[model samples]
Target: MADHRAQDKLAFLLSLVPYLVDHDRVSVAEVAAHFGVPQSQIRDAVRLIGVSGIPGETAQYQHGDLFDINWDDFELNDQIVLTNRVAIDDSPRFSAREAAALIAGLQYLSALPEHADRAAVASLMAKLSRGASAVPSSLTVEATATDGTLALIRESVSTGVQIEFCYRSAQGEAQSRRVDPLRIESFDADWYLRGWDHLRQGVRTFRLDRISEPVITTEPITFRAQDVTLPETLFEGSPEDLLVTIDVVPSAAPLLADYIPAGAVTTEIGGLFRTTIRVSHYHGLKRLLASMSGMATVVEPAEARTAVAEWAAAGAARYR
Candidate 1:
């Protein structure tokens, strides 16, 4: 079976066939370029379409049901010529659920004042609602607020310019730095700027909300190719990664799920959830444990348990 994402691409490719046929014999390379896909993908799609057709009277694909193509021209000259095909010119209509999902997504995007064209977004939503069999009334998508800092970061990213800004670290230390904006991405409702940090001379991820007084620079990006890839795991552990387990109260189990990676083994015993988490170092682990207050406790790695206790003690000393 084809992957779902590949199936989606195939569906999109099928929709383009009508337009391609209307233009007469089009080059495979031309179609591939227009769709932003590889030439091989276009050839494969055309080949797949050639073998597909409606079932005939025999209940098997035969004669009138089989699509015909100018194989000689296609294979030899890299051209597509549909000799015989069932009329498939019309665009597919969206189902009620599909239309509703699109409307919700568009509604969220439209609310972003920095990026949306209010009038155009409204027109699109109206058209989608008109086509939908049943418009979704219960669905609502709220947008995050936009501010000058976000606008400055976005501008820097779009223009391929470096930016300088004040960043408050997770430990609450403030510092000024310059960075080449690679991309602005959001994970779990928090926006982060992943870029090449000039001060640290490395790739770093900074929370967008932590940035202040951002200044877009005239200076162009100077980061090397090797410095571009963001790590698969953002905060790496010292030496090596460790698998840590924690016993959580049932009430706090839901919160633990958010921090735990997918597929990590979890078990419930006597109303307590034993959840395993992977972390790079004690610093991050301690912080996560601290966030749970007194609802969670380390179950293994005595060192981590001690570290968390010490960390809590240090935090307590500040108030004393």
Candidate 2:
């Protein structure tokens, strides 16, 4: 929390100018309460703001450029009075990436008919684009959840109901499971349903796209305090997970950075980049290696190399 003080102070300063201008005069305690910070912090922020100003004619902080605060009213009494300050009437502008993020989120929200105000979303996106420094022409975000899936998940969340769905695991196995839906979240370009999995007897996060035959059950959700406190990191590597190394071509090497764990060493040997990646499961690794075509090859761990070879051979046989 202490590390975020600089950010908090900047935000306070931006908001303080407008707030002080609107109220004309306000107590230090009132400002602290409104901002949800301690009075001392607010006083410190005010003191900092008083010294902050635009450069004067002489290129120094002169009296005309400095923020004027009524020292008598603030120091003697616990009140604040701003005599003069630069006008901060305009709202803070969003950067290009920030604008893009909001626009993308609005696009996702606009996909759901139940929660969408289509016109408002369109208007806001237009405003964001106009305000952005430079909007990217090629940036795009695909909708992660289908209308039916989103509707059912949202209904279950709102009514505290249990939901049943046929989930296709990463290993390509399908199984029926009932879950008390807690929340729907989007992470890493995918929508996930965080719920209490009845079959596993634990909180699990299921990718929405992998869910099939979803049914909003009549049964009410069974309250579990632990479900609400489930960790955001749903996937964890186990001891059984494979530590497989792959040699990727120079052009494909950079792409592996997104998939490989941080601090994983990569070295270029004979123009091919080699890096080790921990595979949570063989099926997932096989699928990833298959998608890379012949650009990537398993270099070590004879088991993984053999598995990928067999997987590739099978795929080749299908085309032949």
Top TM-score model: 2
Model 2 lDDT tens row, 66-122: 888999999999788877664342357688888888888877776542343477778
lDDT of each: 0.73, 0.76
Q: Give candidate 1 regions above 4 Å deviation.
A: 1-92, 103-148, 223-227, 238-287, 290-296, 299-320
Please report how far candidate 1 places residue 275 from its true position, in Å: 9.3
What is the per-residue lDDT of model 1 for residues 1-320, given as tens digits with 9 covering 90 to 100? 46998889767766766656554578998898888888998888888888877776798877668667899999999998777655352256577888889988887655332333467877777667644555555568653453566667656655657889999876578999899876555655577777789998878888887888789899986863344776765443344667788998988787655457668877888778898877767786886776777788898899988888898889899998
Q: Tell me the lDDT of model 2 at 7.
A: 90
- Which is the leading candidate under lDDT? 2
lDDT of 1 at 237: 34
Cα misplacement distance, residue 158 of candidate 2 (Å) = 2.1
Model 1 scores a C-alpha lDDT of 0.73
